[model samples]
Target: TNASPSNTQTPEHSPTTIAVVKGLAWLFGSGSKTSTAIRETRTAYDLCAKRDNEESKFIHEVCRLSPTYQTWFQIANLHVWMVRTRYRALPAPYGKAFEQEFVNHFFLDIEDRMRAALNHKAPERIVKGYLTEMRDQWMGATFSFDLGLVGSDAELSGAIWRNLFASRGLDGKGELIGKPGKIGESRAVADGKAALAELPFHLYVFSAYIRRELKRLESISDEDVMAG
Candidate 1:
């Protein structure tokens, strides 16, 4: 997906830009020190706050351009997830302040748009369902964070698999298929689309959480997976 260029550019010929382009080149077909540095820096963050920013931005773009029922749900869910996990990590008053800033800048406006999309009965259930998904993602995020703090590869891998599977909405019984909705709708069913539309937000959050978790695992410095 083409990310709309930010009004703020890192400078076309500057180190960051050169590094990003070169890093993409390597990511597509090779490897390099710059790419490694980028990976390591991302690993250093608890999760990719940057990627969260991008995902939030992408959802906003979708909301603005397509504002479908599903896109509205997606945008709303992503905002809620950001508030729970990434926003929680910010320091002191700065965290709350930054979170409010994001809401004011993007999410609050999206909420209004979503409200307009809802029929006679406000889609409170849809919003609540998205919140539930956020809660689950936060739980998985915490699990991953703990794994990093403890530096346990076994725990990390196991937790990652569990998180990934659960995020997909499967259960031990194999009866629960697809992500949960606020109301009793299934993404599997046609009417479930209204319910599932915002589900991509949950998927997006989980994927970001997992990516950060894997990077944390890789940055563990001395873990030898083969030795296990």
Candidate 2:
């Protein structure tokens, strides 16, 4: 009898072939997905940036976080995290797109700010390095808050301390913890100790703000959020 078809299976796909497949898959059907993500970014940017009055009030008035690029990043990161968490309720794909746009907007805004203020006329490479460091903080906040949200009240408070307070725990007696003498760095980190004195009040208000936003977002229809 003729031997059965060769028992050997076809060779595995080559790396190049796999990459081409992925590219084609994304390209062929990604137009709407891309549009969807872009819309999310723009709408969120408008709501988050243009309507930043409340956030600014708390950060400056209640929290008293010193005005600087890092503080700005922290505030932005906090709000963005709140909104991003809400999007997790969306169907996975859509939610993923929304979350991605949320972060992309954060970085994009930072890039613009860096060019105008931080790196001011510096080479692109210098700015990129700063941005890279920021990316670590961004990712760290994402997880720290995630744990805090699910963990104990103390956990949430700890996350806020580490992030919103620049990891300055209570051990330092309201200083930079490691003897952060002076504060020429970042416009005026010297204000940090002063701000830390208000940390208790800041933590209370900020934690409340987070809880309230979570509740408000729950009531909002997915479509309404997308509309914004």
Candidate 3:
């Protein structure tokens, strides 16, 4: 049957509209490939939380001081540094190319999630600033561990204590306080030594978890899927 001109006309989406829709879907879609990255990151957090011993006491305390989201960020930063250091120390089987690709995608996915969660576009300057700060922290952490690696046990302990406490010692009641006195300082040093004693085992566990997750990520067939 013949229809009126208006009834027969079909609406077509403009290229701009199509691109915007696709971009939105890519950004906020439920079936995003970034889901895997996010899941694995949460698993890392779970790994940190599951350890309940002297080896993990410092981590637990740090996590306790922050809210859940902040703890996740802290864990993510530490994991990123640990993974990078591990790969650098012992080259990955897939080589540096794959390592670089994976790390790049990991943070890109994290940034996307952050933007979506905030429900607003973050300024490029601000994002770059944060990335720079994170990089600085990563380098600082690597340098601290390097010093520990080559130095005496006391040096290693001191490094650990400085990092965990951020140079501010905690009181007996777990309250954050100023620099410790002589006896308090001694106690903190002793605590660091105890933690350092178990650092090797803790690092082993951390390395294993990250390696497993990264391998899982590497197994993704579509490289572009993770390139977000």
Candidate of highest lDDT: 2
* Residue runs of model 2 more than 4 Å from their true location after superposition: 1-31, 50-57, 169-173, 176-197
- RMSD in angstroms between candidate 2 and the native structure over all alpha carbons: 15.1
lDDT (Cα, 0-100) at 97 in candidate 1: 37
Tens digits of per-residue lDDT, candidate 1, 1-228, equal 112123223221223223433443443332233333233322332232233345655533332212233333333343334333444354444334333333322322233333333322454556544434433554455556466435654454444334332222233232214444322222332233432454455445545665574455454433221111
| Per-candidate RMSD, Å | 15.6, 15.1, 15.6
Winner on TM-score between 2 and 3 is 2
TM-score of each: 0.30, 0.73, 0.41
**lDDT on C-alpha atoms for all candidate structures:** 0.37, 0.61, 0.41
Question: Which candidate wins on TM-score?
Answer: 2
Could you give the candidate ranking by TM-score, starting with the highest? 2, 3, 1
Q: Over the stretch 1-228, how does candidate 3's per-residue lDDT look in tens digits?
A: 001112232323233334433443443332333344444434443343333332344555432322222233445555554444433333223224333433544344334433333333455555444444444554576587567555755555555445444443343333323334211121233354454455555445544554465565455443332232
Runs with alpha carbons beyond 4 Å of true place in candidate 1:
1-96, 103-117, 123-184, 188-228
Which candidate do you rate higher for TM-score, 1 or 3? 3
